[model samples]
Target: MSDSTPGRPPALPVTFRPAHTRAVLLTAGAALFVVITLIALLLDHLSPGERVSFVFTAALLAGVLFLLARPKVVADEAGVTVVNIVSRRRLEWAEILQVNLRPGDPWVFLDLSDGTSLPALGIQPGIARQRAVSDARALRALAEDRSTPGDAAPPG
Candidate 1:
C-alpha cells in the first residue's frame, strides 16, 4: 500500500532512547560506584591506594558514556538516517531493498541488493515498537516503489 498521505508530509522516522531508562541506569551505576568507593575509603587498615580511586573514576566515566551513547533513526523524503553515538549512516530511498519487522530481534536490519545488511542501530524493537513499525512501513513502501520496472538501481 502507498505509505504517504494526501497533504501530510511523510513522518520523520525516529527511534529515541527513553530518557527515563537512561536516567535510571546512569543513576544506579553511579550510586553503586559511589558506595563501593566509600567502603574502600573507610577501610583504612586495608591500605587502599590510588589504584582504587582510579578504578572508581573509570567506572563513573564508563557509566556516563553508556548514558549518552544512544542511537536514533531518522527518515525524511530523501532517505533514512541511522545515527549512533559515533557515526551516522544515510541510505537513500531507492537503496533500501526491504524492511522487515521482526519483533524479537534486537535491532532492525535492512537487506540490500549486494547481500549486505545495514542495521537500523537506533531502533530497539522491545523499547520503541510503535515508531519502529511506522518507519518500517514507510521504508518498505519506498523500497517497493523503487524496485518497479523502470526505476534505476541504488548506488553502492
Candidate 2:
C-alpha cells in the first residue's frame, strides 16, 4: 500500500544525513589515501610487492574511512534505505512499526513489523539532536501515512 498513487499526494523522499562534521573526515581520508599511494610509489627502498601491499593497505583504509563517514538514511514514498558502516538495508514504509530514539541510545532505531529492530545510524542523537528528532518525526509520519489500515501484516 504505497502512498504514491496518482490521485494521492506524492510522498517525497527525506534523507537524514550527519551534519557537516563528516567533511573533515572525508577530506582527511582522501588526502591520506593519495599521500600514502604517492609515498609507496616514491620509496625506492621498497620492492614491487611491498609497494603493492602499501598501496592496497592505503586503499583499504580509505575505503573504510569513506564508508564510516557516509552513513545515512533515505526515506521515500516507497520505503527507507539505511546505510550503516558495513551494511545497507531497505525496508518498505509498512514494515516500519515504530521509530525509537531513547535518551540512552546513540542512534535512532526502527522497529520493524517482523519483530526486528534496525538502527538508523544517520539520525544520531548526541551531535544532531534537533535534526535527528525532526528526521524521526518525518519518518514516522511517512510510515503512518503509507501503512494502510486493515492490513494485518507488513509487506512481504
Candidate 3:
C-alpha cells in the first residue's frame, strides 16, 4: 500500500542535536544570568534604580534562552526540516539537488533546485567524522530514492 519506490528502503527519521555553538551559547547565557542576578542583588543595597537594570537583564536572559533552545533540524523519509538559529525551512526530498559533506563545513548544506542551500544539523563536521559520513550517506540515499532515474545527480 506504500507509494515508496521498490528495492529502496524508506529513510528513517533522524533528529540531530543543536549545533555546538548553540550549546556553548546556552551555557554562557546561563552563567551570565547567574552573574547578572548576583550583581543586581548587590546593587540593590547601593541604589534604588537597580530595579530598572534588573528588568533589562532579565529580558536579555530570556531572549538568549529562547534562541539557544530552538531546534536545529529534523530529517525523515519525506524530507528535511531545517530550523536555522533564527528561521525555519522545510525541503522535500525531490527538491534537494545536492548535499555537501566537505570538511570544515559546520553543517550539511542541501542545495535546492533554485540554487539556494539549506543546512542540515546532522552533517556537522564538529561531530565524529563517522557520524558525518553516515548522515551524508543517509541523505544521499533519500535523495536518490526520491529522484527520478535520470535525475540522480552527484552531491556537491
Alpha carbon lDDT of each predicted model: 0.62, 0.78, 0.66
Worst 10 residues of 3 by lDDT: 1-10
Clash numbers, per candidate: 0, 0, 0
When sorted by TM-score, best at the front, the candidate numbers are 2, 3, 1
Q: Write the per-residue lDDT of candidate 3 for residues 1-156, one digit (tens) a residue.
A: 112343453346766554455567677777777777677777736465676677577769867675755746566867778876678888887788887878677777888888887777645656356555565666666776675555567779
Local error of candidate 3 at residue 76 (angstroms): 2.4
Q: Which candidate is the best by TM-score?
A: 2
**Whole-structure CA lDDT of model 3:** 0.66
Give the RMSD in angstroms, all C-alphas superposed, for model 1: 6.3
Question: Measured by C-alpha RMSD in angstroms, how accurate is candidate 2?
Answer: 6.1
User: Once model 2 is optimally superposed onto the true structure by TM-score, how far is the C-alpha of residue 90 displaced, in angstroms?
Assistant: 2.2
lDDT of 2 by residue, 101-144 (tens): 88788888999999999998877766667666666666666777
lDDT (0-100) at residue 16 of candidate 3?
A: 57
Worst 10 residues of 2 by lDDT: 1-10
> What ranges in model 2 sit over 4 Å off?
1-11, 148-156
